[model samples]
Target: MAQTIVCINNAGMIMQFWIEWVNDDGTQGWTQANSGDYPVDQRRSLDMDALNSQGESIPPGRLVRPHVQAVAGASIAGDRYITYTPGSGTAIYDVTGTSFNYSVTLIQS
Candidate 1:
């Protein structure tokens, strides 16, 4: 089964988000759902399977991390590393940020 992470930008400003995971080979990996900044009320979905450096599906039971950051020309606002397991169901997260404040919420589904 494939796992997904959905990000809803609730912040008043534009933002960007991504997920990270340790590959089977012990290297760092990351993936972003959108090619550009997400505006308020925007939502995007990313597959956990393609989060690795090689863009391969993550093995079952592996741990994954989520991250959210601000867009260019904006104050440095970011948060990360909410641990998650693959094969569990879709993971929905809400991202909010302002000036220097940022937050991430894992919405139970």
Candidate 2:
């Protein structure tokens, strides 16, 4: 994991995350579902559609705090670490792809 600051200058906050592993499996599976909705997991995902100050693209690689998204009713924005924690029981990815993998992390309530 990357050494991260909880927030831009957060002294302390119960920050948690839920993660999703998106594989290029090209098939529908449990992993394809909204696993982030699982309350048990400290679920969090990046708001891929979020815009920047200049309305420019701000993906995870760009570190968009305001764009860091969580499930509905969650009160959180982006911070520093992009975590890797998916809901339990089931595997992270539903299908196995012959291609690379992408991770989606979100905030937890």
Candidate 3:
């Protein structure tokens, strides 16, 4: 399929990117990195390709069920309830449970 490509920003500058991972036990986690240091584009392209390949098996732009925990004592790391969700238009996150800290990274499909 020919996808309509658009530039989110024309100017090239250092940006922060969050990389998420899923463990063997089905738990999710993420870490933050500076785009200036790594090839963020490569990672984003891979992630987007994985999502797009999902096709219609799952609803696009919907949060993956069973939100997982962040790193140990994520609150101390300044991240709480770390989760991944897909959406477009205006980005928004519905945070719940303050008992745990959260650092959410939304990926649009």
Q: Can you write out model 3's per-residue Cα lDDT over 1-109, one digit (the tens) per residue?
A: 1121111211122222333445546664443221222211222112322444644232233233222222222321212222233332322222223224433333232
**For each candidate, what is the lDDT?**
0.61, 0.25, 0.28
Residue 75, model 3: lDDT of 26
The residue-by-residue lDDT of candidate 1 on 1-109, one tens digit each, is: 2377777888877877666666678886655353257788888777665554355545555555556667653433123333445555676777776735767777643
Cα displacement (Å) at residue 22, model 3: 3.7
Kindly give the number of clashing pairs for every candidate. 0, 10, 5
Candidates in descending lDDT order? 1, 3, 2
Per-residue CA lDDT of model 2 for 52-80, tens digit only, reads 22243322332222221233333432333
- Residue 52 displacement in candidate 2 (angstroms): 14
Ranked candidates, highest TM-score first: 1, 3, 2
CA error at residue 88 for candidate 2, angstroms: 25
**Native-to-model Cα distance after best TM-score fit, residue 54 in candidate 1, in Å:** 8.0
- Return whichever of 1 and 3 wins on TM-score: 1
Tell me, by TM-score, which candidate is best: 1
Highest lDDT model number: 1
Off by over 4 Å in 1: 22-28, 32-35, 50-54, 73-88
Alpha-carbon error at 8 in model 1, in Å?
Answer: 0.8
Clashes of 2: 10
